[model samples]
Target chain A: MMNPISRVAKSLVLLFMFFTLHATAQKITPYLQTTSQVLELPSRVLNETRTIYIHYPKADSTNPNKTYPVLYLMDGESHFEMLSQYTDYLSRWDVNVIPQMIIVGIVNTKRTRDLTPTESIINYFGQPDTSRVSWMKPSGGNERFLQFIREELKPYVDSHYKTQPYNILAGHSFGGLASVYCLLTHPEMFQAYIAVSPSFWWDREYILKLADQKLKKGGSLNKTLFFSDASEGVSDSSTFHTNLLKFDAMLKAKTVIGLRFEYNYYPKETHMTEPMPAFYDALRFIYKAPYK
Target chain B: MMNPISRVAKSLVLLFMFFTLHATAQKITPYLQTTSQVLELPSRVLNETRTIYIHYPKADSTNPNKTYPVLYLMDGESHFEMLSQYTDYLSRWDVNVIPQMIIVGIVNTKRTRDLTPTESIINYFGQPDTSRVSWMKPSGGNERFLQFIREELKPYVDSHYKTQPYNILAGHSFGGLASVYCLLTHPEMFQAYIAVSPSFWWDREYILKLADQKLKKGGSLNKTLFFSDASEGVSDSSTFHTNLLKFDAMLKAKTVIGLRFEYNYYPKETHMTEPMPAFYDALRFIYKAPYK
Candidate 1:
């Protein structure tokens, strides 16, 4: 014999509890996971310990046998997350094109020191800054930087992670210049190379000369290269665009066998903005055909 | 008085201990001082708990008086990381365009139900789909779905986080349809709308018809909109391209004041691959003039 009002109140409480618990239980859980590691490298050239940021897809316990290709990117502090996200999404279980690769972001200690070749006074404006404590001080150590990668870094990464031998070296601006340098000097280091708006004017275009010297006429240099430039450092005079045109022509003139290359010019995009589209296009171009 | 071998062994032991301590020290150091929380919403209509991934930029404790714009993204599960990474990188003190904003990724539960305006039997191939448990079975609930967003989701987000009323709603394909629907039905919900590769063929082009009905001729609909499409479900005979062309024409025909709009067509890109480039273009187009 319960009163009608009391019975209604009891029912209301029960209903409230049910809704609350239901809402609490309905929480949507995320399935995405990530793993990261920091490696400290003693750079004898710079006499400093450089920390590299390495981010890889979280190993799926269910499929332990899967191995991944590696992408070595310069300007790690700048574009690590971009590459990481792109790699993760493109290599998703559903949308698999590129393999789930390890991203080795070489964080800059002295950007100019590692990314530039030939210690010179040339700036983006093609004018020399003779000022002391200029940002360009202690420049042109890309050769040693490449050595660090070829000798020290690559071995360390291969040993620690499940990796495929196929590797890609990517860079932007001075990092772009470094990527090209690697391609010309140490062609065996990477299977593919991506240079987004390389400062080809670096050291009076030292790498361009190297390319001309290294690549013989109609020689076979089996590799994939993607180079792009945005509406950056492009003036009324022949500076940015001209340099890229020269590089493009050099590759074409060489008629280098097994050299699959593409040059993209984004007049609408700024230097900073070019990486977004360029990186996407680069990945697509690199993996355009199945690994032959 | 130690022998040479004993000295070498002692040095090796010291080196191992030093390395261990160094590794421990590195492990304790955090890269980003930011933390994020995941939000879950259950929809009785969709029969699923929709997971909305969120990334709120770490509040600068030094500057207590700060607020941010919100970028509401569709297809949350697919492109959340891309947007998150883009926002984080672009808004760094180095490359600031848009203010550091909170990212709200609206994951799909009933994608077809929430995105399509009408229930139609037409399939992608222009054939009637009569199969049981078809993906298009529970369709044409976008209006109610929008109500859920405007009433339930937005309120919850505003109440919990510090947000400015200026919001951007972004989507792709079916999500794109929902975005355009929101713009037409609830214009006050967001300041900007982005529709990438919208499935214009949905419900025999119901949205195009709705747009004609809702958008008053020569009216002022002060809002920004970006719409784009790739080669999706398009062959020699399909009307996907024609449908988009008609929609674009309708948009242009309306002399809506303060209506900023951009239409892009990527012949090289496919529907599945268009999101990467389309999203980038959308962001750049939306933020272009104001930034310049």
Candidate 2:
């Protein structure tokens, strides 16, 4: 029912459409996918089955024999994913500076109990809140918490996976306090430590005094340490920055051998927001020199 | 055949050994397993089939409807894993600012051809290389390359997966030049554009000239742009810093509306090393003011 010229035009349009469809059918290749699992751990100290989160790089045909370093993070429930992603990207085979590492996020059952080093009735503002809902009621159980890690957790991870002995202990706030605590008490447990906005005023700077006592004059302590503080507002006319400064000075005076350390102050960043840039800087500083 | 006391002591040692083995076994847990896959893409424009590496987060049993934003990265074979890990970590439900985004890495087929705009014989030294092994032999195929993305690649991605319209385009070096090229030619293609150490030295700074021409005076251009440069040594009495400064001036003079722009220069970082920190800074700058 159509003329030759009209039919010719129609066929040309159909041909163009067909080629377009074929071109559009080309598929895009994805670069990365991740999976997260909830791991249950029985903590004899807490007398409860605590759920810890573990994030690791997935294995592919191209990299089946790859083994990863481990970063045991505190406050795992809060910032586990942040550290997981940071390690994954920084150590990517292509990015390749820091080695691909496994992230073992230790979720907190009772933050006050596990992160604090000593029992104290004082709060952040030096005021005692003896209320039933007091956040500091169950404080000072870090020694037992560290025991949970040394006795129960580390063995579990080592036996279950292909892990390198190089380990890093990292945390923020109370978790940050715990990171420094672990470094001071159990230095041999980890190769590196990261403490972001550590609660240095805990039990009137208990960890500060401990560091002074444990780090003997002219003694050798070979380890890497990264600590940072953000703009934490003053409560009771006492600034958090002052405490951090004092702690920084204490560590500097010790001058422990092979102690690769960096202290960063983020004025524009808040306590909660400091992790974004702090973690990135930490990784860069930790792996500044290439791993041979 | 031994004496009673000696036999009893041997039996006690064996019992102790059995308890130790049983205790160690109780402490260790099984390793968590994950999987990965590789994807391939064939392009007629470059006459090559490129391999794209992929890593997907393992699906969580608790949350299944978590759709991710897609980051279409240039120079996939170079920095794909870095970006992948950054996004994954920053978007973990705890440290969420930007949503968890899927990374679509476009591996280069013809590096020089697809990334450049004009077919020129100009080398980095501002002289023509007329030799057979010239790196710029088949230069200037960005138009067709972008066509492949618009008609062929994007459609394929949209059809194959769950993608939000909010997309980001990122690149470094020559790939950085391509990022700006796409921004000028196809303004609406991506929500954000990241160019780390863009080669403004390309084609006598053709992209800079094009930016001046296309960006109309007092016009609204709603886009987030993060560009940066690193120290590339002072050569021929000229430094890489001067080039970046010029580009920064051009953007400031235009003063395009709704265009959020941040420029960073790393004096200590090298061209190859800048991407690590620059990319991290860019992400922070892009998401500085989070959506409530």
Candidate 3:
């Protein structure tokens, strides 16, 4: 054999060539074969341009004109890929726990403005002439935001894609708050709602009060809802867990006709980590349907 | 003003152009900004070509040269993206539940042949598989498969990726069988093991028998393991659930030195759906250590 130094150099050259061939020659494709699209939506209601991520079911040869129920998810930037992956996997032919549905992920512009129900400077701890230059100011433009969805986004999505009339609204934290607010103010919007760790303490429980006022006892409101909390505020004042329990109890007491709801508490998970499992379970619960 | 029909036509035209711009002018990036690479690895040990998908942690400007723990996942084609997404999401600055892990997904070729341990044609219901061209004919080549992993795959990964000394092995179903086999036969290959609903029923419980015979009364097989099962066999003969219980009990009784293990039972989930939660829980369990 030749000297060790040259041998090492020669081996490196061969390895480099091998990787070069592997990189360029191989038919490298994305791990997830996604036909997902990013759409730019201009809104007159909010007077701004918004970007939304849309994930549609892979074209099925079996169901050529198959229309899908749409799940409108919030905080698209953080969890769009996640929800896309979950929906794709769970609805696979082999693992058919849930139905194949379209996902419209609404990316954030002014999160605090759009998600909250009231323009209050109040903070999470129940007191605030808050911190100077707090990002939580200019809150609560939910009505105008929903108008954008109702008048513009929904029509656009329905016109562009193959969509069923059935709709599901899903979100976490502030987005969750928006989902609850939508249910109270505009119950006709979605057939199902998933509010994972909703910020229910917003503006002295405005949505909670709205729910109590709007949800008539034994009323004919047909809906499926899944709300959950993970280790948030269970230790101290228990505001988060307590708020969820209060809402659950309120729903039970009302016993609204055709309304189905479930509440799950995750003791181990945190706020940020809860969405993955919560959303999956929500889909499972929502689609457990001889849906109307 | 335009008539209703013309208005509709004009709206459609505008919508088309809007989508065209959204498609063309806008920088529409893939949801998950991935630096993942697909490598075609030719293995001498098994005499087959293997495709491995590698998901690295995104470039950290702060720690540009940082090495990472690698998780070798079987059933690469099925769960690679899930694991990749999980690792990415969990290791995010906001949702810091687990350490960032490099996932090396080994795509299956002859899945049944490679994953099974004993070369027997026995079926799950404790009968000799007598069907014409039973898929279980080429039952066992796990030793050689592990050899391929140890000799070819691991070295390739260590050399190619910015990998730490620590490694984790994860799998489900038959893939789970391979994971347990790797633990028993080649514990040094990985620091942690995840076997989600392992097929202990393989070859009249070959893995269980091996666990019985090989595991000393008080052995020093220091390793971290998380194994779980979902809604399986608990209704009748309970072979699947019982097998897991037996293995769990055996481990506890043996009390192997430095062996930290946990068994989880998910009664609500099915075998096909268990991997999503199990793998997430497994990572949580394994990396709960200030790892050795």
Candidate 4:
């Protein structure tokens, strides 16, 4: 039994409150489960400005002082988000297959220089490319790149983040060559290695020769490795498929007791599409056991 | 050539600028490719506040008026980011496998209530649970849930966002059951459906019987579907595996035309882990051709 004026005023007030609440509740915020940081790292080793993307595991309330294993990824600009998403999703409380690990994506400043093991004028077709501006020019700075990673990037990440001793180095294509090369040349740098279609064609199959040399060195190496190839191996028509096979066979002939490895071949998938599956499988293979 | 005091002053200035640049550049921000909005929509159909997470594709400068297919994903809290990341990665300028999609994630308030098609006391082992405080007490409100999506949610999305005519419904586990259920009952709602390990054992195989009835109706269904099962199928001690087989066979026996479908079986993976690969495969299968 309110009067008309009173009822009207009450309705207007109610409407105003509802709209205010509605507007506040409708605040559009980011729906991200985890956060990542981008650092513009100055590198004297490569003489260039390097971009680093780091995705740390979300702080666990159960263990505040928990330290995580570090996964150093190459081709950050291409696959950083994909790896970060996988790590976050797979290491979830309910979906706990892989342990929580910090992902440090090292973006390439110079692709050919940092990834290839040796310098050469040779192209993919077993012919020398004497072009004025070859894509493979200014190459063979991988040793210096690794020095930068080991001395500068590793130190920076270790001092800043909650990191465990276990380290994994992962990459695709030329970056894959860098990963496998690091395993042979500097095995102490990483506990595990993932090479998704390592380009062995560089410098007249330098990686295959390097692997052979490392095997001949006869040092008992304790490491885990996962390498893969895609349809491009055959379509390239330059012994790309056979090179991968030879690499696999060379690893299998390893008398080195502590080396555990798996090689996957994606016949249906192309070079680019292969990473999508290869990365997932590599993670599964590497993190079969949760790291403490 | 300069005095000691002047040199010291110059060094200090340089150091100060370096520190300022370092501090500003080190300002950690979110590394998200796209932002998502969480809208608390008041649904009159369900008489509750429905939480919706919508991930719209980044604005394309080339084609500002581009409308995207909306993927209505159940269990937004679990797999929304995965779908969003996959869509972003696959639709990149260089690695263009799939089209950019709008992911409308429908998180559940009452998972059991909203997902199941009918109310029943029958459990997974075909046994009745008469407990007073049962998990399935307030069950079988899926029709109401669909009503909410259709009457309230879909209209809200269509009006507010840049959505095309094509719609996709995707879910896993009980959510998977809902996706399939929606297809059989309301086939016109979405052009594509993805059900990862659907629970065919719900309420004494009601979904199986429903499929039979739908098949009997004999109307042509022009749609794309991708369904899969994992290790839990055989381990459940029920007809989960066989039911999935029956569903696949029934679909294959289709006198009705235009239903393009693929059924994948992952024997090595668990139910929880299956979604990782299943969703990726589903996306690849549905978008075999880039959507216009």
Candidate 5:
């Protein structure tokens, strides 16, 4: 038998030969043509700098003037890639379930500060957290956040990219709350809204009350909204599920004209995992073709 | 009143101001630290160059020698980004459902040639196509394809990356059929297998017969296998769903020792949409903690 060092040397020679062969024949390219860019923009309304991820469809040289709709996503750090992958797959010529659109993922600096619509220190269990460094301390700057989107981010994106006037705002949990809040206050900002497991428990369901007031019976709210809740507080009789039901009932009672809405309850999934399926369903609903 | 040219000029001025302010305050960073690189390796077995997308977890300074399990994904061009997004999200510290694993997505040159096991030119309806340019022609290269993976790709990955012995092979559709075939014939190759919407009707249930023959009754076949079928033939009787049921029943009858298996039926989903949820379920099943 050969010595240990000689055997190792023989293996190295074989490995080198294999690599040499690969090097001669192999050619590699980037797997995805779709590109995402991270840009930090100064938010004059919020008095801060915000980082946003902008993912655009691969350019079509054949159609130079081709413009696409835009989707403004909250909780960019958590769900940007998921939506990007979904939109890319669904919009493929073979899978053509939805049209290709631009995605603007807004990364968070202070989650509670930017996403919450009102200033309150109330915790999830309806208890007030009096701690100095509580996450709820810097609560309620969503109005300014919306202003930043409408004035600064939107203008920049619209000016730089080929985009249609139609837009969709999507979010989850606190972001979901923000989506609902936006729909209630500035319904014209987006043509469609998707709220995945919105935290209706926030500030004693402040947004729910707001929705009750703003959405009058037979109001002309011409927009599509898709909201959902998962297994959160499922063990209890009344919780997020009930809150969603209340909201749904309110919408039904109000009979807002042209306000196309869908409510999905995923009893098996958690708040985190619900977004994977909910977002897909939301897209399909938003892009569902008109009947023959 | 301003004319069109004057309005355009004013808009340009405002845009310039916005850009100047952004340039002063903006900062940009790459969004996804978990970067994937595309590499092409020449396959001596198939006499062709194969492209593979390699996605790795971000480097952890805390544990420089940290290793990960490997997931070999077929139909790379179709589902690479989705799995990459899933693995990254699920393995996050906050959402610690599954451990982070390196994903090697093998892109197709000749898809049917590499994925199908047998050389028959049978269509989806079990009819033989005698056409010269049939996609089914130049088939039955799966064994050689497996040889390329086992001999060329896995060795390259093992040598290069910090990897654990635990590995998984995942595929969908034809790729899914390939995953099942691999699990049945070459059990030692992967510790786990995931087949999402596998095409069981391939060559009139070739793999089903193989599985029945190879998996002996009460034999020691230590592995984890998760197979699923969606709403294919839901409008009719006895199709992919029935095929899955037959496979599941065979497993039950044989009672293979050390084999952990689960079958999921997604009637609400289609062949394409099934992977989005099935993959998530598969990961959860694979990493489920023991019951109390």
Candidate 6:
């Protein structure tokens, strides 16, 4: 092995060479840079500023006027980078499985407040936690959150980015429940919806009841939906998996025209581990076609 | 829809509020940033400069002295960001499927010259392409390339990064063939190997013959290997998938002690799209364990 001193000298020489070469030759940036921008959007409805993580596709000079569909994802801090990376790779020139998408990751300040649709003291278990410092203390601001996205966030994104009219809304857990709620309540907002392990046990299945009431039989629901549940129900005593099955059954019962949907069950994966594979499957489902 | 002028005004107001809040409150950078560095290393073995993409996991203040396993991926330009993103997400606090790894993506300077093991004029078809400017003109320099990795590249990485002794070698197509060659020739270099849709039809299945000759029956070959093939053989009328099956059968017959291996075949996936799912499966296989 080379000694530490020589290594240091070598590094110095390499650095000098790099600078000189950079000055003379093309800049030595990576072949492609995944530019992730952090933006703070002022939410008029929620009365607070929301942080958004926007990941744009690499610029195509040949097709400068090309626009892309947007994937607006909830829980940005947790899964934004993953989706961004996935979108970039799957939509690459070599691997043209999916469309190139602009990923808008909505970072969360108040998870329960924004994700939950109702203010309830009930926890994951069938017990009530009425403590002031409970994690679920501030719940049920999802409607306002939706209003923020519709009235403020959507308008901002539309004006700023070269976006096609098609959009997708994706979420997991409570965020997943919020996605289902959005699909039932505001289906026109997005062309497709992905809900990975949605918490259907929220408020004793409030969303399920709403879905039952809202979705008319033989209704013209022209949209695509991808939802999933993992090993949560099998491990925990809760009926998380059962709830998803019920939702699937409800959909099968209703004859909504133009409603394309796929429900997946991953018994081997946990709620957290499910998203990696689940999200990939969802993309494949949404963009299923013959290889070009 | 909001008018352009009003949207521009809204953006200005948001930008002003962002700067003001940024100054007063805590800086709004995300909690975790998957930083990727582009490195240019002058190589003496190959007599050429090489570009390397290194992606480090988010630093942990709780464990400042944490060292990570390194995953050295071939074809860095194609899949560096994807692997970086996968590593970040799978090793997250909530997901926790795999250990956090330092990804060293070896970008290609000359694709065919470095990735192929043998100097041959045999093309993908059963015929020879002897044209002067054929893509296969610069046939093989893989041994010299391996020397660069073993002597120059590995030393540089070990000295520069905080790395554990454990390493993984991953690749696809020609890169995948290179990975298998490394595993067969230099098994001690990496603890694990992932070959996604390997181009096993290279040079009239030279690697297969080598495997048969070199790998003694019931030899003590200790390593973790994951290899797969998609629908390439069926489409191209080539023996890519058949070659993998033969290799698998050879391994099974050999009964190499301490050789942990898994073979996956994705009939639905093309050679290009196979890596996305196959890599994920390979990770799961290598890191298979009960949830902590």
Clash totals for all candidate models: 0, 12, 0, 0, 0, 0
Q: What order do candidates take by TM-score, descending?
A: 4, 3, 6, 5, 1, 2
lDDT per residue (tens digit) for residues A4-65 in model 2: 99999999999999777556543443323455567776656567777777776767568687
Model 5 clashing-pair count:
0
Every candidate's DockQ is 0.34, 0.14, 0.26, 0.48, 0.39, 0.28
- For residues A1-292, what per-residue lDDT tens digits would candidate 6 score against the true structure? 9999999999999999976864454223534456668877766688787889888898988999989999999999888877887888889888898988999999999999999899988878767888889988799888889988999888888888899999999999998999999999999899999999999898888999999999999898999999999999889878888899999999999978999999999999999989988998899999989523
Q: Among the candidates, what TM-score does chain A have in each?
A: 0.87, 0.85, 0.89, 0.90, 0.90, 0.88
- Candidate 4, residues B186-228, lDDT tens digits: the string is 9998999999999888998899889888865456789999999
Off by over 4 Å in 1: A1-33, A43-46, A58-63, A235-238, B1-34, B41-49, B58-63, B235-237
- Evaluation by TM-score, superior candidate among 1 and 5: 5
Candidate 3, TM-score vs. the true structure? Answer: 0.90
lDDT, model 2: 0.77
| TM-score of the first chain of model 4 | 0.90
Which of candidates 3 and 6 is the stronger one according to TM-score? 3
Could you tell me how far off, in angstroms, the CA of residue A36 lies in candidate 3 after the best superposition? Answer: 1.5
Candidate 3 C-alpha lDDT tens digits along B1-292? 7799999999999999988765553244444447687877777688767898988888889998888999999999999888998999988879887788899999998999889988988888778888779999787998888999898889878987889998999999998999999899889999999999999989888999998888888879889999999988775464899899999999999989998999999998889889888988888888674433
DockQ of 5: 0.39
Candidate 6 docking class: acceptable
Candidate 2 C-alpha lDDT tens digits along B127-151: 6788888888798988887777777
Model 5 lDDT, residue B102, Cα? 96
Using TM-score as the yardstick, the better of models 3 and 4 is 4
Q: Which pairs of residues clash in candidate 1, taking residues 3 or more apart in a chain or in different chains? A: none
Alpha carbon lDDT of each predicted model: 0.82, 0.77, 0.87, 0.88, 0.87, 0.87
